[model samples]
Target: MRDVLVIGGGIIGLLTARELRLSGAEVTLIEMGQTGRESSWAGGGIISPLYPWRAPEPITALSRWSQTVYPALTTQLLDETGIDPEFTINGMLVLDDEDLDQALDWGARHGQPIEILQEPAPHAIEPELGPRPARALLLPGIAQLRPPRLSKAVRRALEKRIDLREREEVCELLVADGRVCGVRTPKGQVEAKRVVICAGAWTAKLLEQLGTPPDIQPVRGQMLLFHAKPGQINHITLHAGRYAIPRRDGRVLFGSTLEHAGFVKRTTAEDKEALYNDAIELFPVLRRTPIEDHWSGLRPGSPSGIPYIGAYPGIEGLYFNAGHFRNGLVMGPASARLMVDLMLDREPILNPAPYALNASR
Candidate 1:
């Protein structure tokens, strides 16, 4: 029997397989589609949450830990695989006044350098912004990475070390007598001592067959890409609730809309027009730019806005590291470390109690 079977092929599953293999566990990762092409590849690559001060402590902790280690990890990956994920610290600009005082207090308590700006200062930083948002917060510690490149790097890094089974959808868990022994795919059965569901948006559906359904649902987010000059936008800009992320290759990513659209990954013209309008409103220079591409992905959303990252309650040998929602890219690396620590019975790098399976429920 295999030592472990990872059920998803997004960033979480790919990294989990790497960690387990490094720990000397025979690992096999199964994916329904192409590896790393799910929500992991479709995100805007913001390493920090939008107004992170409003997030829960567990979410904040995971994101902060990821920020601490991502630079070194990306550097190592680039050295090894010749693929630069472009992890950059261009910072984030939040142009909203709601909960301004609370966010300031949270930043102070957490020791994150934050500058609260009144009227004209917001316009001075990004002179192209609309006149709606009169206030802003500049968070210099925020960072971003090109998600597609990071995904490619991880897949390349695990090329020889992991048995990557793409185009294989896990239909059910082979659980019996208080423990899960394997998984059932369309082709055949995969036997393993441990099983991890890192399937992103499809996780809750997979677990439902085993009678312990997690409160995870699919949230579809649509994004638009626009080609622009190199110096079109200086920083990752956020106003109201949408954002525009400029890439090093002069591609500005205007994102995203959260909809409960049940595993549907279709990009609509309505959302595209809405995003374009918002993006143009955020930066007037974008009015002349043409949209190059548009796409959508389903993020795994949980009721508590946190992932279930522990042994499934009462299900031996069955674990979960899914339901990270939109923060999967930021949280995946550290979460993989934590999950491997738990699976191998080692001391966790961070407190794992807050993200335990039952904790969220």
Candidate 2:
């Protein structure tokens, strides 16, 4: 029995439970598998703003606020758990003049610097991409966080307080009086006063069992991690919607081809080759970098690319914070902040309009 029962054990669920505990709510977190073993662990750990400057205001505001809160949040969680979560701030690089202008507009209202740069400037910042004639969008304030490490840190931090039920899949959602009271797992039922569904790609299926509308679908993204030279790229690079993230180690992470693969997690040779081809075209130096590994993860996508947040209409004491799509890591912390405010009756940081639960398909 607890004040809140959080479904799913990914980053969003973990953060939501942590914030609730901080606000004096007793939380019980149930994970179908090992905590953070799914898409959360597989993410490239990018805290990004959307491309083409087409993000809605709510998502934009939430992401910007999460940027400020994440460093501090990671620090506090690390101190409490004594584990470094590996959150790095190397900023980002978006090449091409048109993309640069769009990046500037996205950062302009948020006070985050979006600098347009020429050859010398990119050289000064990166010092590796030599003789490149492309214009660059320098997002100096952007950062990255290791989703796996941070998720582990969060689980460890909440271990002493929250009742973590891992490897125990919930088979049913218990509703004694047509209100979310407890979840039925294979092991047993865990009762709670309120429930928040934070399952990432499984969000739609999870809610569907309870006769609820869950507007979430899986968008498969294939990413590759490479063992490469260090300091080769100073910032995360984006060209033609493909991107790269440099690790603290010599390994450079290149990613992500978005496809509607429908829960099929296998990597296609064509997709992998396409990413590699794009890497060579963008940096050219990656031609020497050997590809070590490639993998894929599914993001829960919604109709408008915005997540399904807030309370479910006609469902008392039940809430949703899923469907984050590609920006799950960037939006996780801020989404939790909003969920906490709505659950605890605090003034929300952003207007609760764009992330409406009853959004049309």
Query: Clashes in model 2: which pairs?
Result: none
lDDT of each: 0.88, 0.82
Task: Point to the candidate with the largest TM-score.
Answer: 1
Q: Highest lDDT: give the candidate number.
A: 1
Q: Write the per-residue lDDT of candidate 2 for residues 217-296, one digit (tens) a residue.
A: 88888887877877777788776677788988867778887888888878899999998887777677788888898988
Candidate 1 per-residue lDDT, tens place, 43-67, comes to: 9999987779878888888888888
> Model 1 Cα displacement at 118 (Å)?
3.7
Query: What TM-score should be assigned to candidate 1?
Result: 0.97
- Which parts of model 1 have CA positions greater than 4 angstroms off? none
Check candidate 1 and list the clashing pairs. Answer: none
